[model samples]
Target chain A: MVHKALKIARVMLSVYYAYMVEYRAELVFWVLSGTFPLILMGLWVEAAQGDRFDLTPTELVQYFLAVFLVRQFTVVWVIWEFEREVVEGRLSSYLLQPVDPAWRHFFSHVSERFARLPFAFLLVGLFLLLYPYAAWLPRLDNLLLGLLATVLAFCLRFLMQYTFALAAFWIERASALEQFWFLPYTFLSGMVAPLALFPDAVRAAVLWTPFPYLIYFPASLLINRPDHVAQGFAAMVLWSALFWGLNRWLWRQGLRQYSGMGA
Target chain B: MERYLKVLRLFWGTAIAAELEYRLNFIITALISLGGLVGSLFGLFLFYRTGYQFAGWSWEEALLVLGLFTVLQGFSTTLLIPNLNKIVTQVQQGTLDFVLLKPISSQFWLSTRVISPWGLPDVLFGLVMIGYSGDRLGLTWADYGLALLPLTFGAITLYSLWFMLGATSIWFVKIYNVTEVLRGLLEAGRFPIAAYPAAYRVFFTFVVPVAFLTTVPAQTMLHQGGRGWLLASGLLAIVLALLANRFWRFALRFYTSASS
Candidate 1:
């Protein structure tokens, strides 16, 4: 049984990777669209040139670069995909499969990261090339931890969005919820500015939410700003487990609701 | 011109009626715009709370720029997004053939086909912000009037650029994300151009022309940078508008109507 499941996962990932590779041009555009962090990097780096901010210019550059990478890795579009599946009655086809429909999206997103890896790295490389001084290799343990946190971040974000997507079982425009959710994620997630720059109260409040671990925490880890590393991982795990439970319950309830509609 | 006006009325009338079915979406979008506005203020506050200003811009002046940016963003949501984003879909599905067969110009038809009223909340909030900030700055009617001239031109420039990018879908069928890139870059306009580094200022001014979108209008409003910037913005708008029309025609030449 274990061997069969592993084979299934392999085939799913390979197939999705091939499909994603076919859209190399679109992937490139997507990578470019994620350049919001780089844009903010310019402003923050400029501000850091002064004496007001907590981080120096180089540290700000590295932090935002790490943000750009974390953003690329944890980008989730499963909400949109899942909404479409539920809306167009396409979920019926997936319901016929033995494996959960969620895994298909999971594998597809995972494979897209790999397919998009080169373009993302190329952008980072170009940025570093333009400003060679901003480049710095992360310590080995920090790099490893950052990678692990990034993976966890992806899983957490995916689970959260997928749970929201399950609302499409009842609502026609469930993606609107994700849109509303994204505002807080964009502002509080430390994508716009580092938590270090945020006022003490705001940073303290934001750390309790799962937003920071999604982008800021992993990014901080990459830049060797390891503050409360254990707590950060704990919050991520706690949020993931909570979302995972809620997601499964919703899946069951949404399945019943979906079939009730004669879909 | 009369026929075009009539067609636009009909287009938007139905678009509004159809959209009204989802009345809840209005509240949702308004809440979103409100949340986004607060978040933007927070970001600006983060910069200013440290006693750092964007070079020459005072808090009120930067607020003026941000308000203009918000208005332009509303404009995009109301018109540019709903219409232009469908270009790729039309190309991919071969619906462009039908659009071409219409009695009106395809560019005009495609550009004015749909209007989403959900962006009104943003427009309202932006105007409120501008009024509040301008009041604080003790601006006269002439200042607001001068800003309007450039603001209209800025809208025209933005529409032209967006239309041209959408037109590229005739060649690359699934390139709607190219417009996403444009929107991403437009986020830079939320801050004054002077706030960025020298390279960013040049790039936003020349490469993407984001400088014309909000900064130029705000400058004209504040009576800063003289009328030279406003004149340049108008010239850029006229040229880009013409280029967008010509580019649409050029792109249409490559339309092979794959599905057809």
Candidate 2:
């Protein structure tokens, strides 16, 4: 059974990887859009130069670049695709498949990370060239830990969004939920600023939420800060499991509620 | 001119009537905007909390820029996004033929076709923030009046650039995210131009003109930076507006449409 599952996973991954590569031109623009962190890096790096903050200018540059890389890997759009599927009743086609439809999204997102990686890394390289003084390699253990955390962050983000996508089963414009969810994720996730610079109370409060682990925790680990290592992983695992449970329950209930509206 | 105004009224009237059906979406978007406002405030506060101001900008001065940015955000949502984003869909679906066949200019119809009320909350909140901060800065009504010229120019400049980018869809076809790249870069406008490093200041000013969008108008409101920056912004808007029109006409020449 395990062997069969592994084979299926391999097939889905290869298929989605090809599909993602077919739109190579659009992929470039998508990569360019993630330059939000790089822009913030400009502001933060300058701010850090004053020595009022705990972080150095180089560290600020490093942190935001890591944020940029983490963002590219963890980006999830399952809600948008799933919303269209349910609204158009195209989900009926997926319902007939033997497998759970979630794997398709999971694999597609995973494969997209591969297709997106080259451009993302190229952008990182461009950023490094722009700020060569800030360029430094991560320690081996920290590199391993950061990569692992990034993959897990992607899963947690995907699960949370897909779980929210199931709301399309009940509501017509479920993406509105995502739009609302994104506001907090954009701010609380440390994409806007390092959690270190946040007010002590705000950072402590945000740490308990899933947002920081999605970008800040993994990014901080990558930058070799090494703070909150144990707690961050635990939070990510707990959130992932919670979302996974909620997602499965929603899928079953949605199937019953779904009437194949447009199909 | 009168005909265009009549058409715009009709376009927005029907658009609002249709969108009113999705009352829940308006509330959702408003809540989201409020949350965004709080988040933006929180972000700006982080820099100030450490007693670090963006060069010469105080908290209230910076708030003016943030407020103007929010207003432009609302303007885009209400007008720019609902209309310009559909350029890609039209190009993809070959519906541009119908648009071109219309009695009116295609760009006119395409740009003014939809108006969403969802952005009103952002506009409202933006004005409130402006007023709140304008009061804190002890600015008079005349000061607010002075900023309107640059603000209008800023909005025009933004619309022109966005339209020009959207017009590129005729060739690129799947250029939806191309416009998203513009939006992402415009996130720089959330803070004053002074907040960025000198290199960033030059890039935002010359490369993207994000500095014209928010900081120039904020400077006008504060009675700082004099009239030089304001004239440059107005001139930039006029130039971009004409270029967008020319580019749209140029792009239409290549519009072979889909499935041809």
User: For each candidate, what's the DockQ?
Assistant: 0.84, 0.84
lDDT of 2 by residue, B1-260 (tens): 99999998999899999999988888888899999999999989988998999999999989999999999999999999999999999999999999999999999999999999999999999999999999999999999999999999999999999999999998989999998999999999999988898989999999999999999999998888998999999999999999999999999999897764
The true-versus-predicted C-alpha distance at residue B191 of model 2, in Å, is 0.5
Which lDDT tens digits does candidate 2 get at residues A1-263?
Answer: 99999999999999999999999999999999887898889889888888999999999999999999999999999999999999999999998998889899999999988999899988889888988998988999999999999999998999999999999999998998998899999999999899989989988898888999999989998999977799889999999999989989988998999999999
Question: Candidates' interface RMSDs, in order?
Answer: 0.7, 0.8
Off by over 4 Å in 2: none
lDDT of 1 by residue, A24-70 (tens): 99999999999889889989888878878889999999999999999
lDDT of 2 at A130: 86
**Relative to the unseen true structure, what is the C-alpha lDDT of residue B171 in candidate 1, on a scale of 0 to 100?**
83
lDDT of 1 by residue, B204-245 (tens): 999999999999999999888987898999999999999999
Per-candidate TM-scores read 0.99, 0.99
TM-score of 2: 0.99
List ranges where model 1 is wrong by over 4 Å. A260-263
Per-prediction TM-score, chain B alone: 0.99, 0.98
